[model samples]
Target: MINNNSVTFIMAGRRQRRRRWLLVTGLLTALACILCCFMLLLGNTIYPVNEVLRALSGEQINGVSFAINTIRLPRMLTGLIAGFAFGIAGNTFQTMLRNPLASPDVIGITAGSSAAAVFCILILHTSGAIVSIASVIAGLITVLLIYIFSRGCTFSIGRLILIGIGIQAMLNALISYLLLVGAQQDIPAALRWLSGSLNGSQMDELPPLAITVLLFAPIVILLGKHLSMLELGEQSAISLGVNTDMTRITLIVSAVCMIALATATTGPIAFVAFLSGPIAKRLVGAGFSNALPAGLVGINLVLGADLIGQFAFDVRYPVGIITGILGAPYLIFLLIRMNRKGDL
Candidate 1:
């Protein structure tokens, strides 16, 4: 009962989809690159591109050298790496759980990191590496707790999501309580971090995050085929020879580490994680792995929003504020649509 015409049409459609994915992915990469350049070149002094390049090359372009090498380069690198981590990790959770609301931002993971970082800053009187280390550890523990609780009868994605939201609320309340009880002088630093600013990014803070991403991003991508199968639901994925438990565990740990490291570096840059996956999904369409594309979208969002925050208004805003402004409306729309479809 097979027909050549139908087969031909399907092949053509597949080819077209591939083309679209390539085009969109390439465009996203180009935009991210442009934004990175702008981050380096358009600070208070506005160094030219050639000057930035020369400074990066260690040629020392007078005033441009310090600003470019010390401030802008670190900031740009932080945003780039952190954005990719958030994007890829977010997409992994969303795709694996088959729910947009499963993002770490919505599901308590970032809250775990934030809570730990805040504790370090306010209670322990810590500043640098201690806060980052505590954040990563706390994030991992949070995921483990969520998994254990959600596995009562069987692993249910809905149950995991609900529990994550509940945990997020509890952690947020804890954060508030800590803020209230902490020293008044430490409050400003904690608040600035909670707002997710890149105001004082430094080169020394980049290594752990950069190294984690370099090691884990490929693991996530290499597992992308299995991830797509997970979208077919657990039973179907098992039938298709996917090691659902191992795959999910690998993905969750890898993503959490990446995102937690990012949170450690950038203080949870709002919804770059939440927004990147859906945007990449929309841009790339179906049948292609979205992990890389989502990362690229995240890079663009962070860099673009940072630029907008810096220059678009009289007073500068953090990247999180701008991304929150962009993501909130989309979240509202998605909730409404999901409600109508009975998918909420």
Candidate 2:
């Protein structure tokens, strides 16, 4: 049972797994970079890569600077940061809850932000900074309430999800009410924002979102080791010397900050968070933590879908529309599977 060949074979297997994980992560990161570059270059007035770089380097190349640096660069950066945040935040929730359907978009956090932003837009006639501020506040309150209501004698993932669904339904109803009583002039803008376009993103508005991600993203990554242990269930995690409650709270707070900021910046980009984690896991396999991989997948999906929405069809659609079309089928399939298993 303790032969040298057996030991050598096990070592070799680990080495192979390490190599595969590295390869997958590297490839996904590279792909995201390529998509980001394409997002900058492939617009109405296409510029050469060198000119785009020149514009980025703060050189005043007239139209090129305005187009690339002013317009396209901000849009691309918005997509890049927001997509990564959604992906990482969504994956953290799904992995921590051990449920594929527990993303913020599905569970009402995004709904909370949407509802507040719609209210500010249609009713209060707010714009820019105030709307973003309102959405962040609403998102945090929604998640905190969800956590409070979902905690019973003992915490249950199933119960938390059920409660989140109910909250989502209520928020959707609120959004509908706000829409119905709104002025015609305000409704179209609200609808367009709800549809989640990066059309009018400004460089000035991105600092808060960028700052939030920069601060919390490292916390999430640093805790990635403990985060992976969460999937082993609370009792198991505790037995292994992990402080489950502290770990969960830390992660939930960090993730919510990123998710709220991202949503405020770009609205909910359909299912970027919902779809990225599983895809990353499939690509990277299971022996290692896939947080970074999942973020990369989110970046790729958002940027790629945006490109498709912009150029693939005769009429350009919002990025959310394309992602919604792609994610709907997957959602239906997942629902059917869960229903058959009596988990819905």
Candidate 3:
């Protein structure tokens, strides 16, 4: 009963699992610290970590406290929350669809939000909570449309993505039409939204978004075991007593909510959703799921992009543009590699 080879194999497996866990924990901690540092250094008034800490502790140093406490803190926190939510949500969709390219931004949810927000901004002259509500509704509608359109075939991932691409094109065209038709004075706001700026995200917008993400992310993570179990193909999963359709619908709705909330706050940050999961899987050696690590990577990506956009260039650009600049090439590389492996 006590075979040496079996004991060694068990020991090796435990070691590998332990190592992966340690790596994930370490990466999460490091990325959080890095994001904190970036937030401290980002704005025009650069404050050192010590000063930022003192500010958090309610100490003022040359108005650095005000700058950090009042302005940069809210912006940075919003970015972190939005990025983390989008990342986890994106990976969940990808895992659900069993395709790396499946993400909320890719699958029309973000585009839907953008179109709704653009309409509100250009035509209704609505700002504040109305826009967020409309955007979330549009996002849900888009998700429902995708489901209805693909209901005939039991929903293939390929068809879903193709449908999403079509929807995205139409939404973009509508946004273009709105921008072209709107007054010159309002074009700035519409264009700012289209370009995905976090510039004016105030303290008020942060609280609800932060609460939503905090409340839902753990729920999604708790369902991670079911997600992974369902990933073993639908028939196999069904055989294992999983309610495949219900599971898929639940995950899809949860993921869409996360993306909608994030897009409402940050105006659809680019590529952090598309990039985080794969980067996390590669970093953590790919055995267990990468949901949490993907979320961490997302936070790092958004924080890093915001820092670069804020300080690296002479003119400050939106973080989304910076992410587009940095992430496009990485995406291209991933495509090329996938093509080489015949996965494209």
- Candidate with best lDDT: 1
Q: Between prediction 1 and prediction 2, which has the larger lDDT?
A: 1
lDDT measured at residue 96 in model 1 versus the true structure, 0 to 100: 93
List TM-score per model, in order.
0.96, 0.95, 0.91
Report the C-alpha displacement of residue 53, candidate 3, in angstroms: 2.6
Summarize candidate 1's per-residue lDDT along 171-256 as a digit string, tens digits: 99999999999999999988988988788999999999999999999999999989999999988999999999999989988999
Candidate 2 colliding pairs: none
Model 1 TM-score, all chains together? 0.96
Note the clash tally of each candidate.
0, 0, 0
Model 2 bad stretches (over 4 Å): 1-10
Candidate 1 segments whose C-alpha is farther than 4 A from its true place: 1-7
Model 2 Cα displacement at 191 (Å)? 1.0
In the range 1-344, model 2's lDDT, one tens digit per residue, is: 56988999988988887798899999999999899889999989889989989889989997999998778888999999999999999999999999999999888988998898889889999877787788778988999999899999998888888899899999999999999999999998888888878888889989988998899888888888788899988888898889999999889888888888888788778999999988988998877888888888988988999999999999999999999999999999999999999988
Scanning candidate 1 in windows of ten residues, the lowest lDDT window is 43-52
lDDT tens digits by residue: candidate 3, 168-283: 88888888898899888899977776676678767888876787787778877877777887778888888888888887777777777778878877887888888887787777
Order of quality (TM-score): 1, 2, 3
Q: Using TM-score as the measure, which candidate wins?
A: 1
* lDDT (0 to 1) per candidate: 0.92, 0.89, 0.80
